[model samples]
Structures are given as C-alpha cells and as structure tokens.
Target: MSVWEFFVWFFWFYIVISCISIFIRVIIDVFRDPELSGWAKALWLLFLVFLPFLGAFIYVIVRGRDMGRRGMTASREAEERIDDDIRSAATSTSAVSDIETAKRLLDSGAVTPAEYDALKAKALRGTA
Candidate 1:
C-alpha cells in the first residue's frame, strides 16, 4: 500500500486499540468499585455492551475522578505488598547469613566465643 494508506491504517489501528483499552479500564473500574452493587455492575456492563461509545463517555464523565482514585489506590496497595515481601525476604536472608558469618569468624578465631554468641543472638532478633 501507499505510505498515505499505511498511515491511515496505522491511525485507525491505534484508535481502535485505545478504545479497547479504555473500555477494559471502565469494566475493571465498574467491578472494582465497592459502592456499586452487583445489579448496578450488571446494568453498567449491559449499557456498555449495547451502546459502547455513549456508555463509555457517560461513565467517564460521571466517575472519571473516582476511577483515577481507585487506580492509584490499587497501585499503592500492590507496591506495599511488594515492599513487604522484599523486606521479609531481606530480613530472613540477612539474619541467616549474618549468623553463618559469625560462626565462620568464631571458627577462624577472628571473633571470640562471647562475640559470636552476641552476634547469633542479634541475628536471631533480626537486629544484625
């Protein structure tokens, strides 16, 4: 195809993809909304299914701000869960490794028995 025809096809493709993305987002928001009862969700889904453009436009106009807020809250919650996982893994690994290193130091006479005991206790307490 000519370059102009290619550009036109590309433009249409992008528009279609954008619309689908927005539609999916709307659907997700509808379900994610705690205030919306099951019947309300069903009605919104039906409206969007039968009159996509108008339904999507009205949904956005009516609830766009709340949609954005819900998205941010979800993102924050996900980040917090990831951070908690990382912290748990780090603390567990560090405590074990720290105790191992202290044992090695004691065996090598680099640390006295008392120091090794203290290190082990600290590690077990998660303060190492």
Candidate 2:
C-alpha cells in the first residue's frame, strides 16, 4: 500500500478505538449513576444500543459533569475502606502477638498466673 493509504488506515483505526473507548465509558457511567432509577437505566441502555453516536453525544452533553464526580466518589470510598481494613488488621495482629508473648512469659515462670490472665484480658480488650 501507498504511504497515503497507510496514513488513512491509521487515522480510521484511531477513530474506531476512540469511539469504542467512549462508548464503554458511557455504559459504565450509566450504571454508576445512582440517581437514575432502574427504568431510567433500561431506557438509557436501549437508546444507546439503538442509536449509538447520538446517544453518546446527548449523554455527554446532559450528564457529563456528574460522571467525573461519580468516579471520584467511588475512588475515595474504595480508598477509605482499604484504609479501615488495614487498620483493623494491624491492630488485631498486634493484639494476638501481645497475648502470645505474655503466654510465653508465663510459661517461662517470669509472670504469675494472675498477671498472665490480666495480660490476656487486656489483649482481648484491644488495650494491649
């Protein structure tokens, strides 16, 4: 093929890729929009399926701003949940290790039975 033909093919390939990317993003946004009711989501899907280019343009024009907000909110919520899980895991692991150490001390005759019981209670209470 000639250079011009190659360039044309490349341009069309890029356009098709861009269109597909936008279409997928729109579909995801439609589902992510919690404000839309079930019927509304169904209608939107139908519209996009039947009239892809027009539906995409209109959806962007009408609800484009909320899409970014929804994505950011989702990302923030996920991060917060991960942080909470990590914090809980760290505390629980430390509590378990503390109890194990206290048990070892008791076995070695370094602490009395009463002291070991107190330590176990403290660890279980998360005050270790």
Candidate 3:
C-alpha cells in the first residue's frame, strides 16, 4: 500500500473514533443529567441515535448552561450546609461562651425573641 492509502485509513479511523467517543459521552450525559426527566432522557437518546451529530451539538448548547448552574448551586448548598453544621457544633461545644454572647447581644437589642430563644435553648441544652 502507498503512503496516501495509509494516511486515508488513519484519518478514517480517527473520525470514527471521535464520533464514537462523542456518542458515548452524550449518552452518559443524558442518563446522568439531573435536569432531564425520564421522558426527556428518552427523547434525547432517540435524537442522538437517529441524528447523532445534530442531537449532540444541540444538547451541548442547550443543557451546558444548566450543568454549570447545577454545579454552582451544589457548591453553594454545600457551603451553606457546612457553615450551618459548624455553627451548630460550635454552639454545642462552647455553650457557656454562646450564652454569654447571646446575652450580650440580647441586652444590646441585637437579637430578636426567636433568636434569643434558639440561642438560649442551645446554651441550656449544650447541644442543638
């Protein structure tokens, strides 16, 4: 075989591999995607199988932003949860300190009745 023949075969092989990889990735995304419902997943799979290139490209364009938003939402939620847990643990571990702080804040009118109740409960209970 000539060098041109080898080059053509290599190019064809590369193209096929790329298409297969794209298809697999798209399928996985469709399945694992939280935003997509069961019907949407089915439709996306149908489109991908029938109109592979167009379907994949459209999905990437449409759902890509949602994926980014989901990531941000998850990160923010995780941060908030960690902060809450730390606050709870700290209040429990430092009950006397928390009560002193709450008392000072209440005396200064910086805390509301509900806030005072919650803080006092945590202080008395030594856990919440």
Best by lDDT: 1
lDDT of 2 by residue, 29-127 (tens): 999998999999999999999999999999999999998899899999999999999998875666788899999999999999999999999888885
How high is the CA lDDT of each candidate model?
0.95, 0.93, 0.84
RMSD value for candidate 1? 3.6
TM-scores, each model vs. reference: 0.78, 0.77, 0.51
When summed lDDT is taken over every stretch of 10 residues in candidate 1, the lowest stretch is: 88-97
Candidate with better lDDT, 2 vs 3:
2
The better-scoring model by TM-score among 1 and 2 is: 1
Give one digit per residue, the lDDT tens place, for model 3 in 23-87: 88778767767767999999999999899999988987988777566657777999999999999
Lowest-scoring 10 consecutive residues by lDDT in candidate 2?
Answer: 89-98
Error of 1 at 103 (Å): 2.9
- CA RMSD of each candidate after superposition: 3.6, 3.5, 9.2
> Taking the tens digit of each residue's C-alpha lDDT, what string does model 1 give over 36-89?
999999999999999999999999999999999999999999999999999988
